[model samples]
Target: MNSSWFRKLLLSYLPVFFVVVTILFFVFFQSLNEQNRKEAIKANEFLTQQIVLFTDNSLKTLNYQVLRDTLTADELRFFFGSDNDDVYRNIQATELMDDWKMNNPIIDSVYIIRLKDNFVLGDGSGQAADFVDQPFIQTYINQKVTAGKWTGKRSFRPYAVEKPTDVITLVQGFPHFSTDKSGYIVVNVSLSKLKKSISPMYNPKLTYVRVTDEQGATLMSDSGADGENSVLSHYISPYTGWAVDSGPTGWGLAHVALHFYNIWVIIALVAVLLGVFWVVHVTRRNYKPISQLVSLIRTSALINPYKGQSGNNEFGFIQGALEQLLEETSKSMQQNQEAIILRKKHRFQEAVEGIVSIRESEWMADLLALQVNPVGAHAFVLAIEIDRYHQFIETYHRQDQSILKFVVSSVTGEMSGLRDATTWAEWITDRRLSAIIWVPDDADGEVLSGQIGEQIVQWVQSNLSFTVTIGVHGIASNLEEIRRSHEIAGNLLQYKAVLGTGRLLRPAQLEGSEQRVHDYFGTIHGLSQSIRIADGAWQKHIEDLFSQMQDSISSRKEIESFLQFLHQQLNRVFLELSKDYRSVWKDSGAELLELGRSWETLDELKQGCLRVFEEMASKLQALKDSQRTRAVISDIRTFIEENYHNPELSLDYLSDQFMIHAKNISKLFKEAYGYNFVDFLIGLRMDKAKQQLLTTERSLQEISTEVGYFNYNSFNRAFKNVAGVSPSDYRKQQTS
Candidate 1:
């Protein structure tokens, strides 16, 4: 009967005891349910995985076997493409199909349809019109193209009396992978036998399993107790594109737990009620000390930013600060998400750029995660560049620029998707977006890419203020091919200098000129020769060089490279000129060299370089004609007079010795001394021979040999022709 406050508080512990006991019971049941579910999932997934792997292995083996025979086997190839059907070869082909059936139980029938004359060949059925699968064969023959891979499940009846058996077919074009409609080779795989190989016997009461195609349509469904309502796990068959779903019977662990433990539900409700009362008792006792501290903090001005926030009595300032922190945290999280997206784009860029290499499986996973299509049998890469990029920059702010680029890529993606082509696109620069597109092997990926390019150009022109140029690379078949595609497509944008903008540019349009590779060394040599002599042909050579550049459709960078090379060579030629003859070229050439790099097109480059060349040629010719000529000719005359005694001394020898051209020396000789190279050499040699005859008494051969003639007869004729007398006769008269 003692009424103490401690006794009342001790009595409140009774409900807390029951609450703790009930929680333990609930946790035990929850753990058991979770454990059972995990076990079921693991077991089912394992079995489903076995089905997928086995099916893939078997089908892949058969596919490769037939593909190999089609490509390598003579009998099979002859049966498909041979105009004259040899009976022995037909039997050999039948034997091959029979071997396929004996080794693999999955092969139901194998046949060849020669599209040329509606002829069919199969097991025991020669090239006859009475073939049972004529209608089926004609369908593929009429389509004129066959799939290289196995097709989805379809019903096939080999004989008239038999019901349709579900089969997956493999249809290959004649010559294995070619696109010719000349013939087709079809292999029918029995779905029943394939499933039998995966699992000979599967129970229906305990679980449900279904295999579905890419369209989510059911291709094969097991006799299951629960149907699809209790699907626990799903696996995709990489070979057949069918989904493998497995699950237990209805209600699984839940039904058992619910029915057997109905009493626990009532007990749990009672425990919750007890928990509520216990919390109330504990909170009242705990609130007195904590509330006093909160009251003191509430009076502070930390949360007084707004009336609504500051009005709360206890813990209001703390809640306001927490609210602001949470808001900031959310904003930071959004930034982090954006960073994640940017990282994904960066990774893609690296892959296409071949900066970072990844395995095929990992790259495929990344593409799937990005919602980008995986590589297909036929793929293409496209580069879309904004027209007049400088104008584009001035027309929009940075944010607007990003938005416009995003629209470009997004529109391309949508257009390609509508065409049933798989596409991935991203902006790789401020004004350029790149995309990789893939279509079914049977579809025309190059044509699709062209159509998509045209649509993008038209759409942008209609909706936006700017248009774009699209450069499409040729077809690609694999990941490595895609990297190559990226390089070509990205490089194609430089062709815009010649192809122009606001249109679709295809490989066909640009491929012809890309092969028109012209070597510039020859033109460079000719230009150098003309400049050395300062001939009028310098302008003609310049025109020829630029015309080749135009015909080749060289890019702006290529043109710049050529011009820079031209400048370097011409500058070397200019430095050799006399100072008084061409002092202004040293300064004017620098200004012209700078101007050379600013050309936007071949025509501009051609015209600009032509003007520079005209000035240069004029100055060079003037310099060559003035004091420079006098100085060079004087040196030439002195060298010939001293070297006339040497047998090899002549115009070519003097030209090499002086580092000048023979033709230039000949022209200068006639200009300076009023005689040709041969005439001057003869007159000098005849004078020396007469002096030798008068003083040394040398023979005619010795005198001719001493005067730069390897052949004596040539020197005798020249001496006689130049001095109007034979060298011997002239020497005798001068001596007497």
Candidate 2:
């Protein structure tokens, strides 16, 4: 009877329990899947906004600053100011523009539109009429000068018979001469090139990002076909009036749904099987307990044993236990998924920050588990920094900045993988991203790493409209040295202060191989001596010092130390000079200090230092020139008196002795003594001859020799010329 009861109970409740559990499982899983989808969509939207912001800022910089600088450059100005018929100038202009275009790959063709001549000079082959006659070109000329305007994508031929090519141009105008009305500068950026700038924003697996003009014509898109039924987000750039649209693939949600469906099937099977087992055990166990109670009532005449009996209590316990188990299992699954995501993120952060310091064995094991095995791989670290980072932060909202960083990190990671390197990247700061790369051991690691770094820079510049500078550390032999490599890369990043932005820096560049440490103390000592003597050579000394600093000092701190030492020595010398000199020195020093702020390279700093010294030298020379002329002449007379016995004592000799020009010495002597240099020297010699004859009674020949005369006859003649008497007569008169 009990066995029959158990079978009936199992049959009644099992189907209902299975249905309830299955419904709950599907509901919970569907809710979680929807949440994940929404989160992913939000992330996509954020990334799209960042793409738009980057594109807008990049365009503005190119138009207002880069193009302006190019147009204003001396090379372009030479072409702009010259007549079109001037062949030499035209050639120079063409070459200059071509070179500019080459350096700036984003520029398709650059044109200098002369309004007065109605001519257009460009990097391409063609006459002015070929480009100047285009309808869009004329329209661009008609517009008033404002910020640069885009010409929209259009086809044009540079030569009459040449095939037309499509380009989008940025047109800007400035007066060729202040009064000239007709000159304009037109810079054409190819639509393809402009599209290329934002190409990094597109990832087929993540989001579809594209830029479009006001007319809804696509300027650039990763794929031509928009996904069907995809969720689209749009960001309109305020600077360019262009729309950036991004969306996930239409199949993304469906794929997620399919994934969840498979998971649900497994979950439902497990839940159903466990529910069946619980039902069977409860039914079988309850039969024995219930039968014992019924037998007791029948045999012992227990009056109320069955009077207040309720339905089997085990069913309620089984249902409650099943619910508890299902709840705990669902919680465990969610926790596991979250833990997995957290672990991956943590590992990536640790790797990029170079904090993963573990034993070789454990490190390899962790890397394998994390799917980033560094064993048998060549390792390198690349430190990437955004150019104009402060401006980037100021231009975007806080959230947008975060999105930009995330997008950059993602792109770097993707590019590294494409290059067959295992890459881990993270944001080390607001404007810097650091990546650790591991490639096959036998691969050309340096070249491959450099290529990857350059691609990252180009991709970011082209697609996101922002520039990044990458510093590549040297290749490491193994993962153990990766942190040290990372340190070297970080140090190399400081060279951006010297190398500027939008470049790839190599470890070899900063290793000072091309630099030679010159004699710093020797140069400084020379400079000090020159300053003290007020010699013009101080300028040269200063120049040499700065040159040595540039070549020898790779560290900013070392450079600063050298500069400080130079400044202190200068200050000491200036303090010893006159007030006017001190004031001039102070002003020059201040100017040099101001110029140092803008120095982008060691060479620039060197030039600035030279300029300061040159200015000081000029001022000192002027001060020396302003001193009393009479005092110089007086000193000359004293020098002549002491050296009267020397035959070579003439204006030339005096000039050399006093460090004064020969002509100046002669003219000053004539003015001060009322006689020429020759007459003055003769008078001094005659007077000295008379004194020698009167005092010593020496022969006339001896007296002549003593008075700087080569012969007695010349001595007598000199005496006559000065005193109107022979040397003997002068001597006799002196005796009387």
Count clashes in each candidate, considering only residues at least 3 apart in sequence or on different chains: 0, 6
Across 1-736, the per-residue lDDT of candidate 2 in tens digits comes to 4789768776767665766768696768867886766776677678778877776775666666545565466655666667777888878767766765766677777766676676777744344565634565666566543435775567755665666667777766654334344566666667677666666656666566677788888777665236434545677888778887776654565445634655776776677777777777766765777666656545654232222346534334435445556776898999998987678777656654557666667667877786765534578889898876656877889999878888888988888788777876767677777788887777888888888999988898888967898989858765557777777787777766556568898867756435544587678878977976678787788777766655553565566666767777778878987898888888887886776555555666777777777777777777776566778898889888899999899888988899999998888777777888887788788888777877896899988888898788888877787778777777677778
Best by TM-score: 1
lDDT of 2: 0.71
- Model 1's TM-score against the true structure: 0.39
Q: Cα RMSD for candidate 2?
A: 35.3
User: Which stretches of model 1 miss by more than 4 angstroms?
Assistant: 1-323, 373-378, 387-400, 429-431, 440-443, 459-467, 510-519, 528-537, 553-558, 578-597, 611-736
lDDT by residue for model 1 over 183-210, one digit each (tens)?
7778998888777666654455666668
